[model samples]
Structure formats: C-alpha cells, structure tokens
Target: MPDCIICHLEITDPNNLFECPNNHPVHKECLIEWLQHSPNCPLCNEPYSLETKSNLKSDLDKREEEKKKSEEDEARKERNNQIKIIAEKIIFLKFLNMIETLIEKKDFEGALDRLNSIDENKLETVKK
Candidate 1:
C-alpha cells in the first residue's frame, strides 16, 4: 500500500505517491504539500541539515557556560557577605570593650563622647 510522502499515512484515492529507494513511500500530493520545502522527517528523527546541528550545539554550550557563571557568582557573593558580617561583629565587640574600660576608669564623659560618635546599635552594646 502506498503511503504519505511526509507522514507515511496510508495514501487515499486523491493522494498519490512516488517510491524512494529507502522503501519509504512518498505521496505525490503530500510531496507537493509538505516535506518538500522542509528538511527533517515528520516522524523518525534524521539529521537533514548540518547547519542546524552546529547552531544547536553552539547555543547549548553558551547557555550552559552562562548558567555555571551565574552559580559561581552567587557562591562568591554569599562568601563575601559572611566575611563582612563576621568583621562587623568583631569591630562591634572591640568598640564595646573600649567603652567598658573608659567607664570603669570613671571616664564616663570620654565614654559618652565615643558613644556620640558611634551609632545607637553600638551604644546598645554598652547598655547590655
């Protein structure tokens, strides 16, 4: 039985086909209708164009590289943020110790002067 040129559907009366050496029947009406201008098969995947393969591979590689770079950037930013938080804590503790020493020496004025230079959260350390 003759089949469609593109999809291999059974050829009806209005449809006619030409035989290809690959044994896949191709309808004349279907040939004119579809797959003639197109490159790939409708059902079975077969490489019809070399340029399509090349472009697809190149595009995929670029996308993968971009994804990797994005992940690395996120990791780096997290590490930097962690380091900054630790440094801020260390600086706050040192400032608090200095304020405690000043206040113990009955240098409340000096300590208050330092407190005025510092922010409220830093002053909260002395209050604690």
Candidate 2:
C-alpha cells in the first residue's frame, strides 16, 4: 500500500486514499487538510486543479455547516432543559406557597397532605 505524502502513514482504507495529477498518493483527509492552506501536492509540488480546490472547499464548507448545526442543536437542547428546570422550580414554589397559606390558616392536615404528595425521590434527584 502506498503511504500518504502529507501524514507519512500507510493508506489502508481504499476510500480514504487520494492521488494527485502527478500520480502522488495521499490520504483523502490529509490532502483536504493540506489543500486548505496550500494547493500543491506535498510530494511533487504539482499545482492542483481549480476543480479539485473547489470540491475540497465545498466539502470543508459542508462539514463546517454540519458542525455549526450540531452545536446549535446541542445549545437548543440545553436551553430546553434549563427551561424545564425553571418551570419545575416555579411549580414547586407555587406548591410551597399553597402549603404556607394552608399553615397560616391553621389547616395543618391540608398542608401535611400537600407536603406528602411531593415526590421526595424526584426532588433529591433534581437537587443532585
């Protein structure tokens, strides 16, 4: 197997290999990375075609867009989780206020029932 000129590593996967116009071998990923900075073959210094550069740029742009999209998705999910936590806190506080009101009215039994209905396990899990 031919070794990649850029990484100096053996090209084992056929799909991960590429060749320059001068028949110089390189890894597809390595060539793409190198093409971002330079347009010549690393081994022979042969000038690459405009088509090759354009294709590489398109691939790189696509990857960048995908990465940005993934990051945005993660951020949205995190925001949703935070919103859920805030909403739960609001509900918990409302329940506490109700219990407090019951206590102030001297309704101990109603306050106890409301307190007992809260899931202590869920509360502990959320705290941690």
Which residue segments of model 2 deviate by more than 4 Å? 5-9, 12-25, 30-53, 125-128
Return model 2's CA RMSD, one decimal: 4.6
* TM-score of candidate 2 relative to the true fold: 0.66
TM-score of 1: 0.46
- Top TM-score hit: 2
CA displacement after TM-score superposition, residue 4 of candidate 2 (Å): 3.2
Give lDDT per model, in order.
0.63, 0.82
Q: What is the TM-score of each candidate against the true structure?
A: 0.46, 0.66
Residue pairs that clash (backbone atoms under 3 angstroms), model 2:
none
lDDT digits (tens) for residues 31-100 of candidate 2: 7778766788887888877776675787767766887899999999999999888877777778779999
Indicate the residue-level lDDT of 25 in model 1: 59
lDDT of 1 at 91: 83
